[model samples]
Target: MRIAFYGSSLLSSYWNGAATYYRGLLSQLAKRGHQITFYEPDAFDRQQHRDIDPPDWCTVKVYPATDEGVRSVIAEAALADVVVKASGVGVYDDVLLLGLQEAARPGAIRMFCDVDAPATLAELRAHHDHPMHRVLPELDLVITYGGGPPVISAYEGFGAPLCVPIYNALDPETHHPVPPDDRFRADLSFLGNRLPDREARVDTFFLDAAARLPERSFLIGGNGWETKAMPANVRHIGHVYTRDHNAFNTSSMAVLNIARDSMASVGYSPATRVFEACGAGACLITDSWVGLEMFLKENEEVLVARDGVEVAEHIRTLTPERAREIGEAGRARILKEHTYERRGAELDRLLRNVAAAKRERSAA
Candidate 1:
């Protein structure tokens, strides 16, 4: 089937959180014989910061940020069997989304792929005038990256006939274990940008733990983190490239996960790093979330840390053998349930089922 993806960043994730996902999902779909064309707006320096190039499995097209971009996206998606509009690309993408919804011909499924569940719902509820308001019913399907149960209920509550989750998946070829370097080696490390909402959590979970473990070494790798003053022990290595993620994960005894404000509040989205860290065979330590266990076993595959004290306790007590055991368990679980191939297969089934139902309705 022909599928077109319109998302935040199709080939780049430099400052974007959705890159690894695009690469993994699209690549898997491509391998599965689904023709894919990823259309992204050349906005927010995204073109300049391309992290992973589109593989041979799919085509990548960049459109303008202006009104002209919609025409270009429509032209490319004219005959797609599926058309998806993903959230948070920073483009004035409402224009593009509305255009796709209008231009979609029969047989093509048009979707609103909401990566941030609670945030999207909040925006839609707070202001029905928001771009997504009128188009809720026009979409053929709605999918989210996270938000186990509550998310789907909320979207359905808003009148979506069909809603599903296309959770994050790992690409083992890219996110596997490797020898660590001194730069990223730490008792604990976190890699994420500075968002105002997530900053407080970072302070409470990561910085607080770093402060408590003043005698131990810590590392931070990501963009938008230069302005904050850090404890001398916390080494801030501005931005770690896609190439370095494995080394960073392998170096740390345990990698920390700090959920974005919306995800934490909604309670289900685990960052790609969680899967990547575990796929790379690195032990994971995540901030307490309502449904963390649904993704990975709590205190078994993943260590849940509610405060700085808990974070310190986990790190101090973890032995290398235990870390390896936990990492192996996580890797097995991800392969069984969280790899990109697995996610793509699930989506394939969902798409087929939806398509079948649509056909039956049309015949009636």
Candidate 2:
């Protein structure tokens, strides 16, 4: 199968949280003999700050963030066996969504892949005339990286024929345990770009905890936080590239996972960082959310906290030996159950089923 995916960016993680998710799933799909062509617009200086060179697994088509640029790519993408318009492309999303549907050849499977399903669903519900409402019924399938049952149910309610959730998983080859680097050494570290929905939570879950535990060292690695207020114990390292993520995870005694407001409220949504940190054997402390038990065992594989106070308590009492125990357990669990190899196989089956169903319908 040849898949043409229109997404944010695959070569860069700068201000784009979906890069790792794209690389993990698509690379594995390619390994299974699927041909992939990733189309990403050059915007937000992402092309300037690329973390990885063009990958061998896929052909990356970098287009300008202009009307003509998008049209050219859309024409090229229409030739593929599958055409996918992923959410949050950051430029001309509406044009791409409708354009792909019109431009795709007959018998080609059309899919809308949502990396942040919770937020997307909220927008669709709030606005009845949203483009997705019009696009959903026409799409062959709606796939999400997060939001387990809620997202599936919501998309179906919005008239989608089929909706599926493919949760985030570790790409062991890309993200695994590495020797701790001195530059990232800290008691607790968090890596996430600053955004409106997530900033408040970051302050509450991360910054407040740092203030409470004055003696503990904390690290923040992401863009748009250079001016953000923080405690003296906290250090801000702007935009840690994907290459340094292993060191960032391994150097920390523990890492944190803070969900955006929508994801936390919707529940069952796990960020890509969850698996990455665990894959590197870093003990994780995450904010409370529903359906987490479906992924990692509480206390054994991961530690859960309801608020900043609980976060402080966890850091205060967590022993070095215990952190190692939890970290090792977490890594083992992810390696056994949640990896890109498993996700790619599942996706391959889904795509095959969708194609078969289309053929059956056409024959009927």
Candidate 3:
């Protein structure tokens, strides 16, 4: 199938958290003989900060952040077998959502691929007049990167015909163990764009932990944290590019995963960082959330903490040998069960089934 995906920037991970997720899944889908054309707006300085060139696996179409640009891309995207409007396009999202639905060719599979399902669902449910409510029934399918059952159930409640959760998985080729780098060396490090929904959690899980373990070194990498005050032990490195993600993960004794408020409340929504850090064989200490056991074994493959105190305790007690043991176990588990190849195959099967069913319906 020729899949046209409208998403956040794929070539840059600057402020776009979904870049790795898009690259991993779509690249694997392309390898399976599907042609993918990713449509991203050249907004948020992403075009200037591109970490990777247009990949051979998929074609990237970077359009201007204008109404004309949206129309032009939607018209072209309608030609594909599958037209997907992913969440958080960062510009004219409403126009893109409704426009793509109306513009898509008849019989073409129109999907809303939501990267942040928990938050999206919250908005839709809280506001009956939400634009997504208007678009949901028109969509052929709803797919999410994470949010296991709660998200599926919520989307179905909104009268969606079908809702599927394709959890985040590791792209081993892109994120694997590398030699540690001096710049990133720390006892515990976290890499995520500072966002409103997640800042409080970061304060609790990362910053507070750093304050508690003042003697130990800590690292913070990602954008939008330049002004946020932190302990003297914490080093703020703004926006670690995708190229250095492996080193950022490998150099740290432990990496932290802090879910945004909505994701943590909804449970089961694992950020892309989880897979990337674990893929690099980093001992991961993530905040407690439901449905995590389905992805990685607690204590053995990952260390779970409920609060900053727990996070501090984990860092204080975790020996280098033990961290290595957990990291290796996490990496091994991810390679066996959560690689993008596995995710791509599963997605291919689902897409084929959905397309076949649509064909049967049309015939009927």
Candidate 4:
């Protein structure tokens, strides 16, 4: 299958959280003998801070976010077997959505891949007249990163024929145990882009934890957090590159997973960092949310904390041997059940099934 994916930056993880998701899924899909082309805009600073060169498995084209640029890409995308217009492209999303829907035309499978389901669905629900609602009935398939019954039902209610949740998973080949980097060494760590929806949660789960455990060393990494006030015990590293994720994870005694407001409320969503940290053999402590048990067992594969106090206790009380045990257990679970290869296979099956069902309907 030849797949065309239009998404946020693929070569950089600068302000793009979906980069890891796209790279993992597409890389595995390519390994399975699929031809993939990724289309991303060149407007973001990602191009300036690019951590990697273009990957060999797939073609990545960075185009201007202009009318002419989109037209050229649309024509090329229309030729593929599947055309995916993913969420969080960071610019002209409405225009892109309409263009992709038009490009899909009579034959190509049209997909809306929502990297942020809670926010996407919430917008659709809050405003029935959202531009997306106008195109919802026409999309052949709808997919999301972190969603469950609530999100699926909402998308279906908005007129989607089929909506599926393809949660974040590990890509062990890219993210696994590595020797800890001295620069990132800390008792606790967190890495995430700063977004309005997530800052408050980060403050609660990460910053507050640092304050409560004043003696413990805390490290923060990612963009947009440089200006935030920090405790003397906390160290902030701006913009940790994708290449350094494993070392960043391994260097910390335990890493934190703080959910954004929308994702936290939605409940089933786990950020890509969660899997990456676990894959790197980091003991994981995550803020509380519903449906967490479905992904990782509480206190066995991961530790769940509801507030900064709980987070402090978890970090302070964990013995080194016990932490390593939990990290190993988490890694085992991810390798067995949640890898990009498994996700790619699941996607392949779903696409085939959808195509077969469509053919039958047409024949009838």
Candidate 5:
């Protein structure tokens, strides 16, 4: 099958959240003998920090984010059996979104994959400020990377015909435990970009824990953190490349998972880092969430941190043997339940199903 992916930066994940998601999903789809022509806007820094170069197996076409872009994208999308207009492309043009909706006019199975389900839900619930409200009803299927219940309910409430949460899964070939690099080595490490909403949670769960444990080495990685000062004990490593992520996980005594306010509120959204970290056999200390047990066993595979006290105990008390056990269990869970191959298989089935449905409607 031919698939065209339009949304987010497919080539660059340097500081982008969806970069790994795009790379993993597309590469898996490619492995299944599907032809992919990924369309990314030229305006973003993705061109500057292209992570995975377009491989020989697929076509990666870059277009500008402009009036001309819509026409070009529409032209390219026509070649696909399925075209996915992914959410959070960092574009402000609703018209182009509408255009992508229309380009699926005759036969192609079009979809709006909402990676930011919690954010979309928050905005849609608001009903006025967000752009997604106007676009949801017309979309054929709304797919999400996170937000299991709250997101689906909200989308269906808004009159969406079908909505699904794909969730985040691992790609084992791409993510696995490796020797720790000196650059990422630390007692406890946190990697994520800063935003107005996420910063507070980071402070409550991460920074406060760092302050309480000045003796333990802590590290922070991600962009937009240059201005943020921390105790001298907390090492600010700026941005760690995606390639270095496994080493970062392996090097740490434990990796910290800080949920963005949106994901925490919605409860089912665990970031790619969560899977990536665990896949590397890293002991994880994360903020409490509702559906986390479905992924990791609390106080076993992962430590649950409700406050600075839990964080301190995870750092100060858990012995190496215990930590290794936790890491191994987490790794086992990821390998069994969430991997790129599994995700690819799931996606493969999904696309085939959606395609079949499209065919049935056409026949009808």
Candidate 6:
């Protein structure tokens, strides 16, 4: 199958957290002999700070941040067997959606992939005049990043003909354990862009934990965290590249997962970091969230912390032997059920089903 994806930056993990997710899924799909082309706009400073070059498996075309550039992309994308316009494509989301709807030819499967389903659903519910509500009926399918039942039901209720979830999973080839790098060595580490929805949780779970355990070395990696005042023990390493994720995780004794408010409320939505940490064979400590156990077993595979005190205790008291045991268990679980190949196979099945159903409808 030929697939075209219009998403946030695929070559840069700069401010775009979805880069890893896209790279994992699409690269896996390409490995399965599917032709994939990714179209990303040269906006949001992504091009300026790109951490990765063009991938070997798939073609990535970076377009100008102009109207004509988007129109050209839509025209090219409309010719594919499947075209996906993901949420949070920086400034051109509405324009791309409108153009995609106009340009898509008959029998072309057009999907709106919502990487930020919880926030998207919340906005659609709150604003009756939301543009997406007007465009929902035009889409062939709506796929999400695991908001579970609530997100699926809501999208369907809002006139999405079909809604499905393609959960985030680990890519072992990119994320597996490697020799630890001394530069990123930490007693506890957290790596994520400082988004508005996630800052509070980061403060409560990561920063406060650092404050409580002043003697323990804590590392924070990602852009937009340089200005924040951190504890003396905490080191802020701005914008760790995707290539260094394995080293970043391996160097840390334990890694922290702090979900955004929308994600935590929706449950069943594990951050990409969770899967990466597991793949890297790192002991994991995550803030409490609904349906977390669905991904990793609490206590046995991962430690759950309700507050800073719990995070501190987990870091301060967890023995090396116990940490290794938990890390190994988590890695095993991830390998068994949550790899990119698993997700790619699932997506292949789903797309085939959608195509078959479309054919049946056409024949009728």
- Candidate 4 displacement at residue 131 in angstroms: 1.4
What candidate 1 gets wrong by more than 4 Å, as runs, is: none
lDDT of 1 by residue, 238-317 (tens): 86778889999999888999898889878878889899999888899999888887789986788898877898888888
- Residues 259-351 of candidate 3 have per-residue lDDT tens digits of 999899988888899999999999999999999999999999999999999999999999999999999999999999998999999899989
Candidate 6: clashing pairs of residues: none
Location of the lowest summed lDDT over 10 successive residues in candidate 4 = 100-109
Better of 3 and 6 by lDDT: 3
Over 4 Å off in model 3, which ranges?
Answer: none
Clashing pairs in 4: none
The per-candidate count of clashes, in order, stands at 1, 0, 0, 0, 3, 0
- lDDT score of residue 207 within candidate 4: 89
lDDT tens digits, residue span 105-224, model 6: 788888998998999999988999888987899888998877988888899999999998889999898899899999999999999989999999899999998999888999999888
- TM-score result, candidate 6: 0.97
TM per prediction: 0.96, 0.99, 0.99, 0.98, 0.95, 0.97
Q: Over all chains combined, what TM-score does candidate 4 have?
A: 0.98
Candidate 4 residue lDDT tens string, 226-299 = 78999999999999998899999999899999999999998889889989999998999999998998778889
State the lDDT of candidate 2 residue by residue for 275-305, as single tens digits. 9999999999999999999889999999999
| Each prediction's whole-model lDDT (CA) | 0.84, 0.94, 0.93, 0.90, 0.82, 0.90
Alpha carbon deviation, residue 85, candidate 2 (Å): 0.2
Candidate 4: segments with Cα more than 4 A from true spot: none
**In model 6, what is the error at residue 192, expressed in angstroms?**
0.8
Once superposed on the true structure, which residue ranges of model 5 sit more than 4 Å away at CA?
129-131
**All-Cα superposition RMSD per candidate:** 1.5, 0.7, 0.8, 1.1, 1.6, 1.1
Worst 10 residues of 6 by lDDT: 97-106
